[model samples]
Target: MLDTEAFRDRMATLPHDLSEYARVQTGPASWSAHPHAEELSAWALEDHVDPALVRTTALLVDISPTDVPHVAVPHADVAQLVSHREAFVVASINGEATLETMLDIVGLPSGELLAIICSLCARGIVALDRSHRLVTR
Candidate 1:
């Protein structure tokens, strides 16, 4: 008894790139994606992501509803995110806030939060306004 149109309408309310979030239930490993290695290495460890940059950075939606790159075959991390709704919410908030604000609002561990953002960017659902640093989800 799912209402697909209502769901699409809700998605439309978000600032995302007109893409639909896939409904899935599984561990992140099950999603089958390889969030870019370069991105992970660049931002994951020992990197406080420069307070100035984090303060100024914002995430943007890139993929369209019909073009959510991994909807048909999700990336491994997407499964992990299935339960981490806060990360998705934080991503949406990124439209106006900086990463520091995202961290303050979401309260996820920085590494985990950065990973989630990076994974989403890798997937194509989100992007840093400054660079293609993260991809999608």
Candidate 2:
């Protein structure tokens, strides 16, 4: 028993541009410095649409859970994009480690970690290799 009219009204009330609502006030300088700021902001928006799932599917379409997650970018470059727990996940990767291993090491909820990974991937800061392993672009 759903109220179709009410649902339509509620949906109409939502912002036409969710990204406008999601935009962070990083100031003018940050926006200019970071070429991917808008993309990141779009990724940060957590509506019913899952950006992580979309990005993961598009980029690693053939990847499996067993695929090893590796950090190919230099630590200094990674510092610019990730912080806190996300940084820990990037740092914990050494040589070869699976997604499960990263989860165990970072101890973050899967959704949160996946969001971070999606953000990095979207920024061209991380990528997947032909071997189907996560890597830095």
By lDDT, the best candidate is: 2
Question: Where does model 1 exceed 4 Å of error?
Answer: 1-87, 90-94, 131-137
Instruction: Output candidate 2 Cα RMSD.
Output: 13.3
Provide the lDDT at 1 for model 2.
100
Expressed as tens digits, the lDDT of each residue in 20-91 for candidate 2 is: 445654434565368898877786664766665567657545545555656667877888877776777677
Using all chains and alpha carbons, the TM-scores for the candidates as numbered come to 0.33, 0.46
What would the TM-score be for candidate 2 when compared with the true structure? 0.46
For model 2, which pairs clash? none
Q: Report the C-alpha lDDT of model 1 over 18-93, residue by residue, as the tens digit.
A: 3233433333443225567666566554567654344324322432212221122234554564445534653344
In lDDT terms, how accurate is model 1? 0.49
